[model samples]
Target: MKALVLAGGSGTRLRPITHTSAKQLVPVANKPVLFYGLEAIAEAGIHDVGIVVGETHAEIEAAVGDGSRFGLRVTYLRQEAPLGLAHAVLIARDYLGEDDFVMYLGDNFIVGGISDLVSSFEQDRPTARIMLTRVADPAQFGVAELDRNGRVVGLEEKPEVPKSDLALVGVFLFTAAAHEAVVELKPSWRGELEITDALQWLIDEGHRVEATVISGYWKDTGNVTDMLEANRLVLESVESRLDGEVDAASDLIGRVVVEEGASVTRSRIVGPVIVGAGTRVSNSYVGPFTSIGANCAIIDSEVEYSIILPKASISGARRIEASLIGHYAEVTPAPDTPKAHRLVLGDHSKVQISS
Candidate 1:
């Protein structure tokens, strides 16, 4: 079986960051989200992989290269436009050819990987298998409805009135049978051929469609809140290691990993924090669940629960919290000025002044 990774999305939700960089390349614990999916695929023992890319094709290609870095041989399939998930499969037909394949969304994060799911699918050889997870907001995702026997009886894409709380996780297993389903289905009202529709077609035609309700952690890291949450989740498992230099004036608290060439002086870093290689943290407070990316500088600042990307500089800021700072960005206090309240007096208006 081969692996098909869908890395070609507009990523409209993560804009202005997406405007500059590919969403799949966004780092979680200093590792690109796409890299995690690729590594998982390699670990699953599938080396012949195809990556579907969009207009940001050059960037994706540059980052992944021949995929040998991850111990896999890659083939890049370009999609001129991101019509839909089904469209991705439609274009990748040649690369996927008669073999069963697993489709993983590039921006999604699954903590434990999908090796088990792939193993189960290979054993049973279902026409199509989807991973489902109970989500609080089923309306935000493609939801599935199961019958009395736990069979996938219905599928809906972002339904206004969801029939179940079981949302579709980003990982899917499909046999050669799915290629016919994609061709037979028509585009949805949204003008895109959604993969949900293709699965629904299989369900309507009495094909064997299976579902696995995931109990492990899974997140679609599309927006800032989910991105930060994923960062926190990945960091929680980090082991404590001080591979870098630390001055006597610096105090390290809980679990922290200071990579080689990183230095901490007169700063206090609490547990579950990572100071990337070549980074310098001086006279600062690095609190929990914060990942400072490689070669960054944090001076005279207090940051917590934030993801600072590579080469960023944060100095003289009072406090930074719950933020996703992009690469090479600078976070510093604004020029100090007097605080005053100015009002334009209007006719027949009453105003009070406090001094």
Candidate 2:
């Protein structure tokens, strides 16, 4: 079996950040979300992989060259536009010839990888298998309605009136039968060949389109909230390792991993936090659930539950929490001066000034 990973979305939801970087490359615990997927695929023993690349193709290609880093031979399939999921399979037809394959969405974070999912599919040899999870807002996802026997009865893509709370997780297993279904598909209302539609066609044709509702943690880290949440979850299992220098003035609390060359002086770091290599945290409070990327400087600042990208600097900032600072960004307090009122007041508006 092969693996097809989609790393080609515009990631409009991540906005300004996505404008500068590929969404799949966004770090969760200083590791690209797509890297985790590739690692998982390799762990599943799928060495021949196809990565569907889109607008950010160059970035994706540069990061994952030849896939040797992940112990896989990666074939990059370029999609000119942000077409639907089935469209990815359509483009990867050559790479994914008649063999069974697993399709993984690049930006999705699945805790405890998809090794078992792949194992089950290989053992049972389902015609088509989908991973589903109960979500609060089924309307926001491709939902599946299962029969009383827990068989997949119907599937809808971002339905206005969802029939079930079981939302399609980003991992899917498919055999040669799915290719036949995709060949006959017409573009959906979104002008894209949604994978959900292809699966629905398979269901109509009496194919064994199976669904497994996994209880493990899974998140589509498309937006800032989800990104931070995924980061928090990944940091849960971080083991305490201090390869860097922690001075006597610094207090390192639980489960903190200070990478080699990182220095902590006159600061307090409460963990599940990771200070990346060459980073220096001086006279600051680096709190829990934070991943400070490589070579960053956090001087005289208080940051917690935030991700500071590589080379970013935070100095004299009072507090920063639940934030995602981009690379080479700066966070510092405003200049202090004598208090005075300087305003162009609106008409008939109340005003107050501190002197």
Q: CA shift at 95, candidate 1, in angstroms?
A: 0.7
Error of 2 at 270 (Å): 0.2
Write one digit per residue (lDDT tens) for candidate 2, span 1-355: 9999999999888766677789999899989999999999999889999999988999999999999988999889999998899989988888788999999999999988888889999899878899999999999999999998888879999999999999999999999788888889898889999999999999999988788899999999998889889999999999999999999988998999999999999999999999999999999998899999999999987888887778888777766788787777765555553232122111122322221
The segments of candidate 2 whose C-alpha lies over 4 angstroms from its true place after superposition are 335-355
Error of 2 at 265 (Å): 1.2
| Model 1, span 14-113: residue lDDT tens | 7767777899998898889999999999998899999999988899999999999999999999999989999999999998999999999999999888
> Model 2 has how many clashing residue pairs?
0
Residue pairs whose backbone atoms clash in candidate 1: none
- In model 1, how many backbone clashes occur? 0
